[model samples]
Target: MFGLKESEIATLITAVSVEGGGDLDRVSIENRFARATWSGLAEPGDRLAGRAIQQLGAARALSAVVEHWNTERFAAELSADGDPVAGDDMRQAIDRWMPRLKSDTALIALRQAARFGARLLIPDDELWPERLNDLDWHAPSALWVRGTDAALAGIVDGIALVGARAATGYGEHITMEASAGLVDRGYTIVSGAAYGIDGMAHRAALASHGLTVAFLAGGVDRFYPSGHDSLLTRIVENGAVISELPCGSPPTKWRFLQRNRLIAAASLATIVLEAGWRSGSLNTAGHAAALGRPLGAVPGPVTSAASAGCHRLIRDYDAVCVTNPDQMAELAPLVEREIDVSEIDSELRISSATPGSEVSAENVDTVGARSPETTRLIDALSARSARTADDIAARSGLAITAVRAHLGLLELDGRVTETGRGWKRVAVAKPETSRVFRSPSTDSE
Candidate 1:
């Protein structure tokens, strides 16, 4: 049960940390290492892992499990922390995690990832995709990503294009068009990197020179469906290939199902180009529906079994019937708008309007009237990059403690958002912007 010293653990975490090998403070290093350890110890979408980490902090929760804490101690600790779980649940969770609680294995994964230049992203990293949080307790403990910063950030505009692995000619054709068209319109293509429709989608996106992200069921170190090795490699070079599992892990049926949830959640929308009644792509669609994201289905020949799933979704699941890429793009909100201070309606008020003016409000609730500290925090935030609270504090001249507190307030008001281990400013509506709203049912001119 003995573990690495704090300093040694910090070194390993910093090696794979998405902050790109910068010195991290004691608290952050411990937390990131703990999350990476948890990712290996628990299966993807383990609610107890998330809940325990939420209540006890990753480092503390990991320690409790490593020490073989009794059920009573576990329940008591969680209860005192304000979230009480039954002893039976704690006992089961501890049992489920203990078998895989190999600290050495986590160390190996970290080293392997460092060798491959893979990044370990905890919830606090700026590269972490925030939409995954929608999965709540089932969200991944950490993410293993192999790609550039821009490729990862492109997730904000992602739209999932999923379908049957045994895709038909018609299905591949639809996927190609949808993928390329969406790319042309500034969408990032997302998929599981499987054959048929998923492959076609990625290929089309790449052909159009657009960003694409693949969510793997296994480690980013090992590409699944070995035949697609070249395709995934290109993705790593030009887009991103991501996973929740550690470096040496292999793909399994359950992991694939869990991986589908990520493809659904990370994307702004999910479109099923082709599927059979029991197709795995349906799993992705179900996750999309559960998340309340826009779901689109491409229609095909009535006689084709591959199109049955799409029909089922349209008839039974209320999925919008989308025939073309333009229709599919209509599934999500166009973009995150940025507004000029002068564009604030009279009620919102800029008593004195000026172009590109920054307003200062003492009240945190007031949108443009940022407090001195909040103004400094926002000024420190970049629309294109995410910064950890530590970095934000250093840049904004606030203490790390204060930076975190203000971030919570700012996040609640839609002023800033969490990405992996950092934060980014959310773009408000820009001034003098003209938008033509189009209904999904409307025909393209």
Candidate 2:
């Protein structure tokens, strides 16, 4: 259906729209189909694609690709409209997207979603999680949600609870108490649906008969950690299981990292119950901090390694030290911070094309104009400790060859160091002005 009539597209899209898209006007139909197409074509957090959609609008952006517009042509079009994307970036983006541009892929995703009784929520939907807009170019194009609309809507008040998969009893207890307490306080529990703290958060939320959301790295159709299938099913029944990818996508290391951005942005704040230094939960916490979301971490026994990341957050970042549910609840935003965030983003956008742009943690890696792979690889590295290529590969979910290539390039740039043991990230000094990040709301079920 690459060149299908608008009506034809709507027929497929409406099948997965909320209440069969009572609001599916001609423009809405085209945008919905285009975004669903973009969602499947671009990986989550594909900044260039996000830029394309932001500048060109989803429908026209899709048409640009369909019309076989090359980088030069796309850049001219974007430049003429007052947004100039560096040519090399545009070339790389189009190169990656072209191979995945099967005419029927969006159609398949829409059809599969329809069969699965899932709804595709675009930014225009009333039920859309507006807070995610704070992510700007990193925002998801569309979300595939399998559950009640209430569950999706509840993200406004969502508070992400993330930590290690191998949680200690102390961690699980804290999570259970915090999640259930938050539920009692009229909040929706949000987590990634992983083991340990995440699972406990969802389970406690459900046990309390509170709403919960599980944002998946892959498609809603397939549950990751197959062990969590039944938990996910319950989440779908009592809350929602959501994903940015289309029906057939599988969870990978890269997608999981990108997926953390959604969890951090969608929630008003995030709490790290427990995590080791290298735990994936630290990635989520980083996203939360970058978003200027009020981050809190629970302190575990000082001797426990699982608590090291939480301790790191509290010590190194502005993360609040929250112990119980009562203290955790205080971290929620008192006012919507979207306007403040938008203003900071506007400044960054205006300043980005210039040299030496001052970037806050919110968009530090992105504002520097790094490649996505470089950004991911950098995120996978620890500045405090060296790691072998195999460890980096496992952490980044990148192939060993790809990891080595990135490492080599990074080493040349003096961004990482190779110790005899492994590699360590080179810590770069930030400008004094970058200390501030423009920083969000409540959810109900």
Give one digit per residue, the lDDT tens place, for model 1 in 395-419. 4435566778889999999989998
lDDT of 2 by residue, 145-220 (tens): 9998888878877889988887899999999999999999878999999878899999999999999999998889
* Each candidate structure's count of clashing pairs: 21, 2
Give the runs in model 1 whose Cα sits over 4 Å from its true position: 81-83, 336-445
Provide the lDDT at 425 for model 2.
84
TM-score against truth, every candidate: 0.75, 0.78
lDDT of 2 at 359: 24
Candidate 1 lDDT score at position 355 = 35
- Give candidate 2's error at residue 398 in angstroms: 12
**Model 1 lowest lDDT segment of ten:** 436-445
